[model samples]
Target chain A: MNGKYRILLPVLSLTVLLAAVFYLQPRAMSYFGLNLLFNLAVPIALATIAQMMIIMVNDIDLSVGTFVSFVACVTATFLNDAPLIGVAILLASILAYAAIGALIHIRQLPAIVVTLGMSFVWGGLAVLLLPSPGGAAPAWIRTVMTVKPPLVPMAVVACILIAGLTHLLIMRSSTGTLLRAVGGNAQAVARSGWSVTKLKAGAYALAGVFGVLAGVCLVGLTTSADANIALRYTLLSIAGVILGGGEFTGGRVSPVGAVLGALTLALAGSFLSFMRLSPDWQIGAQGAILILVLAVRLIFSRRGRKWKGAENG
Target chain B: MNTKAKLLGAAALVAVTLPGHAVADTADKRIALSNNYAGNSWRQAMLESWAKVGDKAVEDGVVAAADAFTTSENQATEQAAQIQNMILQGYDAIVVNAASPTALNGAIKEACDAGITVVSFDGIVTEPCAWRIAVDFKEMGRQQVEYLAGRLPDGGNLLEIRGLAGVFVDDEIHAGIEEGVAEFPKFKIVGSVHGDWAQDVAQKAVAGVLPSLPEISGVVTQGGDGYGAAQAIKAAGRDMPIIVMGNRQDEMKWWAEARDENGYETLSLSIAPGVGTLALWVAQQVLDGAEVPKDLTVPFLKVTQDTLDETLAATPEGSVANVEYSQEDAKSVIAAAK
Candidate 1:
C-alpha cells in the first residue's frame, strides 16, 4: 500500500529473476551472456509500455501485436529497399490508430471489439507487405540495437531509457495526469473543460509510436521479419501491464513496473530454456510462474487491506 | 446437426452432378483442393504449384477443371466447412493439406461417401478410405542428421533448432534426429530450442541460448529457420558452423555465396512444396481409374552443393525452393506405390 512498496514489488521480482538466471547459468553474469539473455527485451519492454499507455486510458488494443508485426514487415521490406514509401505507410498506419481512437470515442464503441477487428486488418496487411518470412533489417537499426556498451548490455540500456522516459512523461507530467483523469473519471475531466477525446487520442497515438519502436527493435534483433513475428505480444503486453501493478479501467499504472514486468516474463522464458527443459514443460512452467506471482499479489493486497482495517478499528 | 447438413449437402451434390456425370465419366474429371491454412510461404508455394500443375492438366485434357480454396483460419472446423462447400460444388476429387490429423476426418469421410476421391498430403488425415501422399519426414530428419554427422565425424557440439512444439511433424522429425544421433555416438547435442519453424522466433531462441551453450560445431534446423540460425551465429561473432540448411531460398542463396567465397560445402534438403503437385498427380491417376495405392510414401529430395545454384535460380526471391514433379514422374510414383 505504501508508495515505496508499489515500486518495490515489481523491481524486486525482476531482481530475483535475474539472480536466478545468473545462478543457473553463471556465464549469464557476463556482458555477452547478459546481452544474449536480454537482447529481445527491448521490443518486449517497448510493447509493454505501449500497452501500458492504452490501459491508462482504460482501453485495450488487441491489435498491438499484429500492428507491431506490420511495422516490422514494412521495416524489413519497403524500408530496406524503398525508404520513402515505407516511411509513408508507417506514418499512415499510426495516423490510422489515432483515427481509430477518435472513432471509438465519438461512436462510444467498445475498445475490445474495435481492436479485435483491427488485429485481422493489421495481420492481413503484414502478410501483404511480406508474403514470405525473408528480408534484411536496415543496417543502421541493426548496428544501434547490437551496440555493446561498456558495462550493461544495449538491451538493458534500452529498457532503462524506455522506462525512464515514459515514467517522466506519463507519471511526472501534467499531460499524463490529464490522460489518467480521462480514464479514471472521463465525465469529471470533461466537465472541467478539457477535451477527453484529445486525451484519449493522444494515448493511442503514443501507443502507436511505441508499437512502431517495438517492431523496429524486434526486426533489428532478429535480422528478419514475418507477419506472425510478434503476434504473442498482445497477450504478453496485457500480462506485463497487469503484472506491473496496473489495473484495468482504474488508470493506475507504472512505467517502471511495466518494463520490469516484461523483463521478468522474458527472463522466465530464457531461464526455462537455459535449464534444458522439454518444450511441453516449458510452456506449462511459464503459466505456473505467472499464476504464482498473481496469487502472491492477491494475498499481499488482501493483507494490506486487512492492516488498514485494523488501524481503523 | 452436422449429419443433416451432410445429407442435404450430399443431396445437392447429387442433384448438381447428375447431369454432368454422363460427360465427366467419359471426358475429364473435375478436382478441387481444400487447403487448411495459407499464412506461410510454404503454403503459398504449395498453392502456386497446385495452380501451375492444375492449369497444365487442364490444358493437357487430364481434367476439365481444377480449383483450389484456402482457409485463413488454422482451425480444422473452418477447413471442414470449406470441404463441405467443395463437395456441394460437385468436384470429382478433393485434394487436401489437412490442418489437424483427425479433425477433418468427418468431412472427408462425407466426401468419400459422396463418391469423391479425397487425397490428403503434407498434413494428412488418418481416415483409412482416403489416399494419403507424403514424403517420409522421419527419413528426412534422419538423413539431415546423418549428413551433419558425416561432416562432423569426429563428434562435436550441435545445437538443434526444433520445429513447432506439439506439432506432429516437429515430433516426427525430432524423433528421427534422436534416432540418427543415437547411432553416431560421438555427436553431442549441446542445446535444443523450439523455433516454431519460424525465422524470427528461431533467431531469438538461438540468440538466447547461444551464450550458455558450448561452442557449437554445427547447427541443425527444420526449414524456415536455417537462415535465421545462421544469422544468430554470425551475430554472436562465433565461427560459422556447418549449418544443415532447410531448402529455403535465403538459405540456398547464403550457402551458394558462402561456397563461392569460402568453398564451404553444405547440402540443403526439405519436404518440398511440390507435394501439392504430387497430390494433384495422384488425384489425376485415380480419376483416370488407375490403381493408386491407399497410402504412398514419396522420398525426400536432397540438394547438394553441386545443385544449390540451380535450385536457388529456380526459387523466387523470397520463397522456398520447391521441387515440382512432372506428369511422368507422378505416374511413375503412382505405379511404384506399394
Candidate 2:
C-alpha cells in the first residue's frame, strides 16, 4: 500500500456515506438537517482521537468510555454547581492517567488488564456521583455545543477543528514522532537516551485530555449525563481507529483519518434511519455497513499492494 | 353430624386461616433481586423501592434476607452470570428484571431446576418455569391512542415516538399503536422515530423528523418521551398537539405548566418502578408454597388530566411516578392472577 495515500481511505469512506445520507434524505442537505444529523459526531471524534493516542503507543485504554462518562458526570454535577472543584478533579484525573501509564511501564504490567480494571473504577465513581441520569450541563457548554455558525453546522466546524489540531499534534510534531517511536521500537528509542517512560506517560496524559474533551462535549450535546451514556464509546473508538487505517500493534495511526472515521460512523446511523429500514434489521444493518466499509478498505489496500509489487517487478 | 363431619369442619377452618399463617413458613428463605441495569432515573427509583420494601420485609421476618444485585452493563450474558452467582449463593428465590426476554431463559431454568423459585418482572423472561409478572405494554400503547381519540374525535395526523428499536417492549407497543390506528380508521400515523426511551434522544429524533412531517394532531409515545416531543414541537414553532406522556416527572411538570398556561391536556401512563417490590413479595409467596399462577399481570400506573397535579406532587423531581406494593397487594395480585 502507498503510505502517502493511506489517509484517503477514511476520507473516501466518509464521503461515500455522506453522499448516501444526502441522497436518501434530501432534507438532510440543509443546514438544520445537517446539524441534526451530525450533532453527536463531535464527542465521537474526540473519543476516537483519544483512543488513537493510546493506540499510537501500542497500548489500549479499555476504560476510555467509562472515564469519559465519569468526566461527563462530574461536568454536569460538580462542574455546574461548583466549578472550581470540578476543574480540580478533572486535572487530577488526567494526572491519574499519567500515573497509571508510568506504573504500567515501571512494573511491566499488562495495559489491557490494568485498563479493564480501571473501567470498573470509573464506572463506579460515575454511578456514585450521579445515581440517575439527571444533571444540568453547564449553561455555557450547552450554548457552545448548540451554537450555529455562518454556513456549516457547529458539528462540522468542530470536526474540522478537532481533525486539524489532532493532526498537528500527533502527525506533524516532533513530540508525536517520539511518542510513536516509543510504540514502534521502545528499546531502540530508549537506547538513544530518550526516556520511554515519560513519552508513554505523556501519550496517556494526552489521551486523558482528549477523553475529557469528549465527555464535556457529549454532556454539552445531550444536556445531561448518565453513568452509561458513553459506554458504547469504548468499542466505537476502537472501531473508528481501525476504520481510519490504524493498526492494533503498530504505532501507525492517522488523526485526520480517525476523525473522518468517527464522522462516517455517526453518519452511518443517520443514513440507516433515513433509509427507513425495518426496526428488526436496523442494528444488523449497521453491522453490515461497517463490514462493507472495512471490506472496501481491504480490497483497496490489497490492490495497492499488487500495484506496488508490479512496479517493483 | 358425627366425628367425621366435625373433622371436616376443622380442616376448613385451618385452610381459611392459612393465608395469614403462610408468612411464617417463608421467614427463613432468602430472596435475591438480579437487576440488569440501573443507569436511568426509572431504574434508580426501582432500586430505591426494592430497598425500601425489601428492608421492611426483612425486619418484619417475612424473609431472612432480600439482597439486590445489579450488573454494571445492561447485557444479557452479564445478567445471566449474575443469576448464576445468586444460585451459587444459595438464594431460595430469585427475582429477575432481565436484560433480554429470552436470553436469560437458560439461567432462569437452571435456577428453577435447582428448586429455587424464580419470579421475573418488568423485563420478564420467557421461561415457562419462571413466574412472570408482566405489564401489558401493548395495552399501555393502545390506551394512549384511545385517550387521543377521545380528545380529538375527528382523528388527524399523529406522530409516534417509540422506545428503543429491537426491544420487545418497543415492538409490542408499536404493534398496539398500529392496532389502535387500524381500529380508529380516521387516525393516521404520519411519522415515527425511535426515542430509545430517553428524553434527550427523543428530543433529537423528534426535532430531526419534524421538519418533513405534516401538522400533527397528536403524538403517541412510549414512556419517558412526552416532554421531548413537546420541546421539539415547540422549537419548530408548530401548534401544540395532544401528546400522551409516559409517567416521567419532567413530562408531568411540563404538562402542568402547559395546562396552567394554555389548558393543555394529555394522558400519562407507565409501569410503576415499585413493581420490583411486587415481584419481591411474589417470590416470597411462591417460596411459602402459595399456588401462584405461572403468569401474573401488573397494572400500569396512569395519570389523567385531573390527577396530574397529585401524581406530580408525589413524584420526586427527575424521577418517574411510582407505587410501592405491600405484601397484601402482592397476595391480592396473586389471587387475581389465579
Candidate 3:
C-alpha cells in the first residue's frame, strides 16, 4: 500500500458514515444538528491520538481507558477546587508514564503486561478519588467546550486543531522520526548514536499529555466525572487506530486518519439512534457497523497490495 | 395444592421458632458478597450498606465472616470467574448482585452443586438452583405511567427514558411502560432513549432526541435519569414536564427546588441500595436450615410529593435514598413470600 494514500481509507469510511447519518436524518446537516451529533467526538479523537502515539513506538497501552478516567476524576475534583495541586498531580502522572516506559525498556518487559497491570492501579486511584461520581468539571473547561463558534461547532473545531497539531508534532518532526526508528529497528537507531530509551519515554510522555487532554475534554462535555467514565476508551482508541490505517507492531500510524476514525465511530452511535432500531439489536448493530468498516478497509488494503504486485511483475 | 399448603404451614412454623435458634446454627458460617460493578453512586451506597450490615452481623455473632468483592469491569464472564473463586474459597454461602440474569447460571449451578447457598438480588440471576430476591422492575415502570395518568387525566405525549439496553431490568421496565401506554391509549409515547442509568448519559441522550421530538408532557424514567432529562428539556426552552425520578439525591434535590419555585409535582421511585443486606440476611437464614421459597420479591421505594422532604433529608448528598434491612426485616420479607 502506498503510504501517501493510506489515509484515504479512513476518510472514505468517515464520509460514507456521515452521509448515511445526514441522509437518514436530514436535520443533521445543519450546524445545531451536527454539533449535537458530534459533540462528544473531541474527547474520543484526543484519546485515539494518545493511543496512536504509543502505537507509533510499537507499544500498546491497555491502561489508557482507566488512565483517562483517573485524569477526569482529578480534573473534576482537585482541578476544580485546587488548580495548582491538580496541575502538579497531572504533571506527576505524565512523569510516571515516562518512568514506566524507561523501566520497560531497561528491564525488557512486555508493554501489554505492564499497561494491563497499570489499568487496575489507575482504576483504583480513580475510585478512591471520587467514590460516588459527584465532582464538577472546572468552570473554564465547561465554557471552552460549550462555546459556540461562528459556523463549525466547538467539537469539530477542537478535532481539527488536535489532528493538525499532532500531525505536525508526530509526522513532520525529527523527534517523531527518531521515535518511529526506535520502534522499527531499535538496535540500528541505537547504533546511530541515539538513546532508544529516551525516545520511548518521550513518546509515552506525549501520549500521557494527550490522554490528559482527552479526559479534560470529556469531563467538560459531561459537566461531571465518574470513576468509570472513560473505561471503554481503551478498546475504542485501539479500534480507532486500526481503523485509521495503523499497524499493530510496525510503528505505522496516521494522525489525520485516527481523528477521522474517532469521528466515524461517534457518528455511528448517532446513526443507530436515529434509525430507531430495536433496543435488543442496538448494541449488536454497533458491532456490525464496526465490522463493516473494517471489512472495507481490509478489501482496500488487499487490492492495494495486489496492484503493487502487478506493477512489479 | 395440599402438599404446597402443607409446606407453607411447615415454613411458617419454622419461621415462628427459628429466630433465636437460627443465630446459633449459622454462627460459624462465612458468607461472601459477589458484586459485579461499583462505578456509580447507587453501587457505592449498596456496598456501604453491605459493609455496615455484614460487619454488624459479624460482631453480633450472627456469622463468622462477611466479606465483599467487586469486579473492576461490569462483564458477565469476569463476574462468573469471581463467583468460581468464591466457591473455591469455601464460603458457606454467597449473596450476589449479578451482571446478567442468565449468563451467571453456569457458575451459580457449580456453587449449588458444591452445597453452597446462593442468594441473588437487585441484578438477580435466573438459575433455578439459586434463591432470588428480585425487584418488580416492570411494576415500577408501570406505576410511573400510572402516576402520570392520574396526574394528567387528559393524556399527552410521554418521553420514556430507559436504562441500559439488552439488560433484563431495562426490558422489563420498558415492557411495563408499553403495557401502561396500552392500558391508557390516550397517553402516547412519542420518543424513547436508553439512558444507561447515569445522569450524564441520560442528559446527552435526551438532548439528542429532544430536537426531533414533540413537546413531551411527561417523562417516564428508569431510575438515575430524571434530573438529566429535566436539564435537557429546560435547555431546549420547553415547558417543564412531570419527570418521574430515580431516587438519586441530586434528582430529589432538583425536585425540591422546582417545587419550591413553581409548585412542581412528580413521583420518584427506585429499589433501595441496601437491598444487598436483605440478600445477605436471607443467605444466612437459608444456611441456618430455614425452608425458604425459591423466589421472593422486594418492594420498590417510592417518594411522593408528601414524602419528598423527609426522604431527601435522610439520603446523604450525592447518594441514593436507601434503607438497610435488618435481620428482622429479612425474616418478615421471607415470611411474606412464603
Candidate 4:
C-alpha cells in the first residue's frame, strides 16, 4: 500500500535478477556485450529522461526522437568527410534543437502538437542530409565512445551526472516546483504569477539538450547516420518515461528510474538478439513487451491505490 | 483416384502458361505473382523483372492476367499473408521470394493445396511444394574464393565477412569457400564472422575483428556492405592491398568502377545477378512449355581496377549496362569464368 513501495520494489527486483543473470551469463561481461549495453543503455535512457522532462512540465516533445535522428544523420555526414568537425556539428545541432523548443514556446502552441509535426519535419530533413547510412565515425570520437579510452564512454557517465543534477535541481529550485505545479494544475500555476507557457517551453528545450547528447553517443557507437532508426526509438523512449513513475497526465518522473528502465529494455533487447531470434519476430516481441509492461503497470498502480484507500478508511 | 486424376492433369499439361506464337501460351492463363515490397533497389529490380515478363505475356494475349501484390518492406508475415491472399483470389500460378524461408512453409503448402503452381525465387520456400528456381549460391560462393585464391597466390591472410547468419545463402557461401579452400592449404582463412546485412553492423564487426588481425591481406563480403570492410581496413591503420568482393547496391558498382579506375587492388567478382535473372527466365519458359536446361547459370563478372577500362570500353558510356558484363539471351549455363 506504500506509494514508495510501488516504485522501489521493481527496481529492487530488477537489480537482484540482473545481478544473478550477469553472474550466470558471464558473456554479459564480454567486450561485445559491454559495448552493446553501453551503446543502447545510455542513449535510450537519455532520450527517456528528455521525454520525461517535457512530460513533467505538463507537455510532451514528440520531436526529441526525430530531432535526435536528424542530429545523428547530420553528425555522421559532417564527421565522415571531416573528422575534425565533430564538436562544431554537435554544438550547432544542440543549439538548433533548443532553439526549436524556444520557438514552440514563443508560438504558444501545445508542446505535443508542435513536436508531433516537427518530428516528421526533422526526419525529412535527416533524409535530405544523408540519403543513406554510410561513412565512418571519426577515430578519436569512436575511440572515446566504443573503445576503452582514458574513460570509456565518458558520455554514459556524463548522462548519469546530468540525471543527478536534474534530480538535485528538482529538489532545490523554484523553477522545478513551478514545472510540477503546472503539470498538476496549470491554472493554479498561472495564478501564482508564473508563465506556465514559458516554463513548459524551457522544459522542452532542456529535453532537446538531453536528446542531443544521446545523438552524440550514437554518432560514436555507429559509423553512419540513418534516418529510419529513430522511428522505433520514439515510442520506446515514451515507454521508458511511463515506466519511470511518470504519468501521461504528467508528474514526478524520476530521472534515475528512467535510466533504469532504459537499461532494462536494452538488456532485454541484447538478450533477444544474442539468443538469435529471427529479426522479424524480434520487433514484434519488443512491441508486445512494451504493451504488456505498461498494462501490468496500470494494474499494479490501480491495485496499490485501492489498497491505500482501504487502509486510510 | 482423385489424387491420380490431379497428377495426370498436371503432367499432361507440359505446355503451360499461354498458347500461340512460336513460344507456348494458354494466352488465357492467369498467374498470381507476389513479392516482398521493393524496399531497396535490389528488391525493386526483382519486382520490375517479374512485372515486365508478366505484363509482356498478358499483352501478347498469353496469360489472361498476372495478379500480383508486393508486400511492404521485407516483412515475412506480410508476405505470407500476401501469398494466402493470392491463393484466396485463386490465381493459376504464384511466385514468391519468401520473407523467411521457414516461416512461410505452412502457408506456401496451403497455397499448393489450393491448386496454384508455385515458383520461388531469390529465397527458397519453407514448405517443400513449389518448384525451386534459384541461383547456384554454393557455386557462386566457391567460384569467388577460387578467384581470390588465384589472385592472392601467396594468401598470407584473408578475412571473410558473412551475410545474415544461418540463412541458406550464408551457409551456401561459407560452404563454397570451404570447398574452394580445401586444396589451397597455404592460403590461410585469417578470420570469418557475420555482419547481419547492415552496413553499420558490418562496420562494427569489422572494427572489432580488425584490431585483432591487423595483418589481414584481403577481404570478402556479402552484397553491398563491402564498403564497411574497406572502411574497417583503413580504420585499422593498414593499407593492405585487399581484394574486396560482393554484389548488389548501385553504389557498389560505382565503387567497383572507381576502385578499378584508381588502380586499387580490389577485385569485384560481383556476381552480376546476371545468373539469377537467367534462372528465372528459364523457369518462366518451363512454366510455358518451352524446353530449356534443367539447371543453368548465365554469367558472373570478376572485374578489377586493371580491367575497369576494358570493361567500360566494351559498353556504351552513360548506359545502364555500362562497365559491366554483356547481357545476352543466354541458352545454357556457361563458364562465365576467365
Worst 10-residue lDDT window, candidate 3 chain B? B72-81
Tens-digit lDDT track of model 1 for A47-145:
999999989989998998899989988898898899899788888887888888888998999999999999999999998987756576888887898
lDDT of candidate 3 over A84-118, digit per residue (tens): 99999999999998988898898989999999999
lDDT of 4 at B275: 33
lDDT of 1 at B328: 74
lDDT of 1: 0.81
Report model 4's interface C-alpha RMSD after superposition on the true interface residues.
Answer: 15.2
Model 1 chain A scores worst on lDDT over the 10 consecutive residues at A273-282
Model 3 misplacement above 4 A? B1-338
How many clashes in each candidate? Answer: 0, 0, 0, 9
Which of candidates 2 and 4 reaches a greater TM-score? 2
* Model 1, residue pairs in steric clash: none
Interface DockQ of each model: 0.01, 0.01, 0.02, 0.02
* Residue-by-residue lDDT tens digits, candidate 3, B202-222: 999999999898878999999
Collision pairs in model 4: B17-B26, B18-B25, B18-B26, B18-B27, B19-B25, B19-B26, B19-B27, B27-B62, B260-B305
lDDT of 4 by residue, B109-194 (tens): 65677666676756655356675555676776677667677877886677888889757678877787777777666566788878
Clashing pairs in 3: none
Global fold similarity of model 2 (TM-score): 0.52
- Give model 3's share of reference contacts: 0.00
Score candidate 3 by TM-score against the native: 0.52
